[model samples]
Target chain A: MSLTVPTSTTLVELQDVHLSFGSNEVLKGIDLKVNKGDAVSIIGPSGSGKSTILRCINGLLIPQSGKITVGRTRVDELKTETERIALRKRIGIVFQQFNLFPHLTVLENITIAPRKILGISEAEANRHARDLLEKVRLEQKANAYPGQLSGGQQQRVAIARALAMRPELVLFDEVTSALDPETVGEVLAVIRDLVREGMTSILVTHEMRFAEEISDTVVFTENGLIVEHGTPDEIFSKSTNPRINSFVNGLGGRATPLHDGEGI
Target chain B: MSIVLKQERAKQLPFGGIFAAVLGLTVIAWLFLNQSLGQVLLEWLPYLAKGFTMNVLISILAIAIGTLIGIVLGVMELAPFAVVRAPALVYVQIFRNAPHLVLIFAATYIFPFELVIFGNYVPFPDWVKAVVGLAIPASAHIAEITRGAIQSIPTAQWDAAQGLGFSRSQSLRWIILPQCIKRSLPPWMNLYASITMGTALASLVGVHELLHSANDASTAVQRTDFTVVVYLTVLIAFFLFCYPVSRFTQYLERRLASR
Candidate 1:
């Protein structure tokens, strides 16, 4: 399939990205560009390097050979940890585990980066954190530690924490996979709100319906390569690629293997 | 209802049994070893109490220096390069494996009594030597504790902190070390207790600490019959000082864990 470049200005771009762990290659010669205000969903079977792509974008896992650019920052070329940290401030990531600082309160968790990394005043950071908490509908839990919150509440707080940095790009790495079925909607609803607000984001998710509804672009990966990329409707319903077809057919909140008794 | 039931169960604990047992032991000891007890308590105990300050001073100095060294060694142990990690590993192994008494004797005998620093000759006492000896071993143990606590924190926290733009030091200071403090407290208390006990070894090198003072008082009193009373009083004094510290450590551990 031919890759179509979006008309809007590019916010993130990955060129011929390749990453491997020991002998197993996770991402191979992948190319993708995310334009500003666009929400892209990466969906695939378990080992399709879907999460690895998000991790690469966020600099959690550096690509061995690739050019990853976020805005004007060439993330792959960052030589120092100091430079990487400065680059990371422009990008936010929400993890599946909702890795909130359990030692800190909800307000502290959200306000910490702004105050510590950005060197903002405590009063200013707290004010911004309160606004983000109110946006996530969790203003009352400002003093509550992450341990006291439910899985969904914790994920929302994580999202709020990410947003409090005012990052130009946000990445969601299976944010709902660890939550209970009933709680997934709250986290997804927060993402949907982000899409509505035209925040640039890349989400690796298994929820096909949410992906279809919110994503401006849909990417289907199989065996470390993007096999299909297009508008959500075209890729979700009108895809002709056999691998993409099999993946969408198994889109009942799970990625079924294309061949019986064989893994992806 | 379950919370109320737990509170009630805690209230109904058999504290009276513990009180009775302690009282019974005290009475048995008093009856069996009663001769010259008043003399030991009134005369010698005050003299022994005089050395308590020295004991406290040694412990404070040793811990302050030891903890600082321990934290540095701990970070070094986790360093990515072998050049940085090797010396820390060697220091920990040598210090931790050596006996505290041997270490104290070696420090007192081997280290120079006076050193010139900044063009000034500073005299080093037996107490300073003893502290150095205790601190070396304590630093090794604390290094091991710090390393374990830092390693026990999940890698995901590190990744999350990095994703939020925190450098290695920033992640450690704000995210990793704060979490480690809860895990490290109990071991730190245990180390301090051992160090406090190790301070008793200072008496061997003529530091005149609590045990040394007790020995001198016992000899001056010249009461071989009151040996048990004098020694037991010293034991009680050490126990009273250390038990409260351990209990407070446990309390903090439980409280932090619940949080």
Candidate 2:
């Protein structure tokens, strides 16, 4: 009953990545490195392959030519689906649309993998799932279905669901884009909480303010290329890349600063 | 008021006459079953009941098998991955497009085909052939219903599970299938009832199911009216069997809607 607990560092590294879905190319020879502890935000316009990068990291979509590694395991070289699943156990993803299982209770949704794939006993998984629910301040919603919860509440549950896997790297795909303004802050708060734990997160998001406030590195993507890569200040204030500047400044390069002389 | 009533009357209930027609038919049917009291019960009852029960048996077995297989194929056909879904589509297309009669006959006679292919076969009982025949065709219809129900589930749901690191199979097992099964149940049960009624096809293969027994009794008694009573009994029995499931399905539908 002893699974070799992998104590490896060097989480995810993507080198010369290129992917094409028919005539449409998504990832174009992209190179990126995510270390053991890093909070990076990937920001870009629609159709600019921000999400595709996350998918490639998890092996949901394989790049045509890339040398990718996750943990001690090589990504492109994983021979079987079982291997990929085993690897993804270390990599958790929070979708843009919170996909808390509608049919299952919040607790059940969080603990399914622990119970099934990890071979953890149901009682143990439930105990752990309860803790995850508590982390999101949704302990009361442990038994409730996803339908009973609001969009923000559901997203929190999704975050809890991902953390239940206790992954080294968590990917957030525009976690607040689908939510109302009132709800956006709540979801962002949960991500901030994760940052407190030093959980490595790669967030594909449009919330420039949140990105600027929290991320260690912010990459501005345009037409399947990384136009600018730097700290939040570097990107917002001192970015030389015109495409990155225009994208961040919205209204075509009108830098709508968040506060007076406080553009972080 | 009269003009409004005239306009509303058209839409009030177009099928009101249907009740009257059914009542009239029932009276005629009762006369056939109720004629000669003890004699009617003695000669007609056993034979009609026996055939009716056999038909029920065949329908139950066939529908049960069809339902299980349909659920599996249905989930497969709805898979997002082309690798998993393509084979399922091929199976669905083959079965769904083939005539029900052809499937039934082929399943009934499949042992011989199995023998020809493998150069060996098990000696199947007559009941097995009839029941398998009915089930094979019924499954095709059931698979189509299951596929539709699975498809009606939102794509966001599948993606959500995918994002959770659930493999294609795991997502289906834990998330998609459960919802699909619940949604598919009402229509599935309805199909079950229909297949039960259709088990009369056993009579074609010289099986003494309900309809077969009824025909036998009609020929023996030299009374054509017994056939009416046999059919009436069948309709009532079916109504008895199916009404509760239909009600349950409706209740479930309403409950899901409220959610």
Candidate 3:
């Protein structure tokens, strides 16, 4: 399959971003850029601020200092929640916990954002949601509630819900981290399909081999700083930085065999 | 296994068993006193039924008004600004801790006896005042329940809603409050039962509810046996109304816990 031409247009840029929660500095002077149609992945140990960076991009957490540009809006400069909400409309984020609305059916969950925020008609939103559910291979589960679905199934619904907004960029924050080992592969496969479709994605993931397989650029962060960033081959195999070398090899040593089973 | 057995044993002797035991005791008391329970009920049942309806009407109105005000006050307590939260907090604290009888008395006196509507003097009934009084404390208790219910929802729900571009109010209306409704139902039903029982206090202010009517029946009959029978009837009426509510609340709690 031929991939779309990767555009040079920058979709998100963060310059010297620093964020702290009450004296504990999380993201210390971080800088990064993601171009349109590029799949960038951030790999690091827990508490290394990989998720924090994703939160900053979506305007969920405000940095103490930095310039965050998403599309044309300066995210750091948003003065009110309304402004931030407007910025967020163009960005979608999936969390490790899935966080699907338990009270709503799968179809309602996916259609709610477009119907409520975008003022799309219910019929149109439902139609669009059905399409997205088909894309996620969950068309059969549309009427099922989140509680009725498996964790992997719920995460795919979350992804479908995000896509219902037609966002320019999507952030996946360790989405497979909470899944059972047997179920992780199914969620990863759905994400792989999304990334392959030229969706601009920034993933904060712990899946070493999967990241290497899909990411155009792989960033390595430790202790609130991006230590190095380069092509997947460079970061996964060719890097000489001892920290990156040891971390990659250490994860590889404990890595389980990839389960390509589609059944969740 | 022991705990499960204990729970099963506990479930075996439910409200019905206790109610049957109480009825047996009442029958024994009636036999010893040589009083005819049927005659007493025949004479006063109609009058007591009228008063009981008053209690039900007041309870329905008070709960409706209280729930509306409570939802607003509860949401206010969670407001981002202290200016909005402070007054709601103070209101909840004041009414929640205040004596229900005192609030009933205050409502009776605070509101004028009559209202001038369109140049007409309209009588403001005591029952209306009682409803207003009962609603104050009921609203406060409900506000606390609402606040707790909202807080009990995991913060991840809020984060996910925000990331989807939902405004805080939109998230609360669409996502948070729907879930809160289930969490709040058991407690809210418990509150309604208490509020229904609290309607008896309206009798002190001459609202002519079930308790007030029982007192009137006892005074008219001028017999100790008649008084006992009428008062017992009043007690049974309240139990009949509130017992089912509490049982349903427990059922809802168990279902929620299972989920």
Candidate 4:
């Protein structure tokens, strides 16, 4: 499929991004540009630091060195916790664990960040929360506690909670990895529906077929680095990199069994 | 294997065992070995009853002060920077290391002349001084318990709240502290019960609590049996005040654990 950006301008740019957890580097001098209204799927193995990339954008983990700009805010330069927090409200993150506030009902979880941080009145926050819940087809479950819901339902609630903040950019850090195969489609469908409506998204995912369906670009990661980037056709169909060919084949890509030195 | 299992489950007995046993044995031993339960209960029923009210007033005041001080010191201990955490450790060490009775005695005798003097005068009653004395020492251990509870929550929670744009104080006020209070409630309630029972030691310094009232009445009656009876009444008073709060603590613990 031909790629199209869902946004009017570039929403995120990572230049020489380097991060470490005391001496173990997770992101090594990565550089990338994602225009606004774009849907990019980052695919990689379990420990490839795909999730770390999403976390760094919102200041959940600070990069030791380099520059990451999310719209107008510089990710590394936001020094105080307060400054980092102020920058986070503009970026919504959906987690793999579906981190809904288990102590609160679905509606309460969604409206909490908006009502507390943005100072939206209860009536106003309620209206927006209800609208987002409706979008995710979870309006009926508004009164339910997170523990009462199925994994798929919890994920949908998580999406509504993030959207209630009305973020300029949404990050999905392998959000469906923890779900059962039967439940994955429902969440993927919600995300696809959001993409259809022009929401800028950067998704860390392993679903190759799904990336082919909705992504404007497919980024392949390995050893804490972005190894390749192209349209799904170029990366999946006509790749010259032996590593890319081996990696895509291991994912059971297209069933042609492209032979190489690293055969499965 | 069975012995290992027994050891695993053994961390002192539950409310059904040692803790409750201490409460029960103290009452029964006070009654039968020393005096008749009903007769003793009736003897200082007035002074013991009035003293029971006074003891309760001190418990409420101590628990409130303990919890507030615990939160402040607990947060200071958990602060990310070393500047705040280092001094907090000294505070916890000093209080936890010292005997509560010694601190209470010192507060009553020394603090008036040292800290609260205006031209060498303290504008307070003895009872207020005693309450402050009990609360300060009790709070030191409370601060340590509170810090451990706060630390046990996943740092992801703090990160999540911050990612949602909450200020550090706001994140704590909204999320972290509520969970800590819920998590710490059982031990905290036990701590409150402990120091309220410790108030009997206040009688040694003249606080007029249940045991003190019993001492006064027994001396007035000139009977050791009367002292036994008064002490049993004090036991009853402690149980009456502590049971509801203990039950509430259990209810909250189960709810939080399930979450």
List residue ranges in candidate 3 displaced over 4 A. A258-264, B1-13, B24-37, B251-259
Q: Residue-wise lDDT of candidate 2 within A1-264, one digit each (tens)? A: 001222235678888889899999988888777756678889889998999999888877788898998877788888887777777888899988886777788888899877776788999999999988888889998888888999999999999888888888999988887887667777887888787567888999988877888777788887788877888889977988887777787822242343222221
Candidate 4 per-residue C-alpha lDDT over A1-264 given as tens digits, one digit per residue, 9 for 90 to 100: 223432457789888888888888889887777877778889877788888998988888889888999988898898887787877899888888887776678998889898888999999999999999899998898898888999989999988888988998889988887887667777888898888777888899876777767888888888789898988788888889888877777775542243121111
Please give each candidate's TM-score.
0.91, 0.81, 0.93, 0.86
Q: Give the alpha carbon lDDT tens digit for every residue of A106-139 in model 3.
A: 9999999999999999999999999999999999
Error of 2 at B59 (Å): 0.9
lDDT of 1 by residue, B1-259 (tens): 3356346436634553465457557745674577456645576767788898799889989998999999889989998899999999999999999999999999999999998999999999899999999999989998999999999999999988999999998999999989999888877987899999989999999998998988887777777756656676677677778867766775676677665
Candidate order (DockQ) = 1, 3, 4, 2
The list of candidate 1 runs beyond 4 A from truth reads A1-7, A253-264, B1-36
Docking band of candidate 4: acceptable
DockQ for every model comes to 0.73, 0.41, 0.69, 0.45
DockQ category of candidate 2: acceptable
What is candidate 3's lDDT per residue for B141-250, written digit by digit as tens? 99999999999999999999999999999999999998998788867987898889989999999999999999998888888877877787888888878766666766
- Compared with the true structure, all predictions reach lDDT values of 0.85, 0.75, 0.89, 0.78
Predicted structure 1, TM vs. truth:
0.91
Q: Write the per-residue lDDT of candidate 1 for residues A128-218, one digit (tens) a residue.
A: 9999998888999999999999999999999999999999989999898898776777788778777778788898988777788788899
True-contact fraction per candidate equals: 0.85, 0.47, 0.81, 0.53
Candidate 2 residue-wise lDDT, B131-199, digit = tens: 777676667777788888777889888676666567887877777778876677666876777777667
Clashes of each: 0, 3, 0, 6
- Superposition error at B117 for model 4 (Å): 9.5
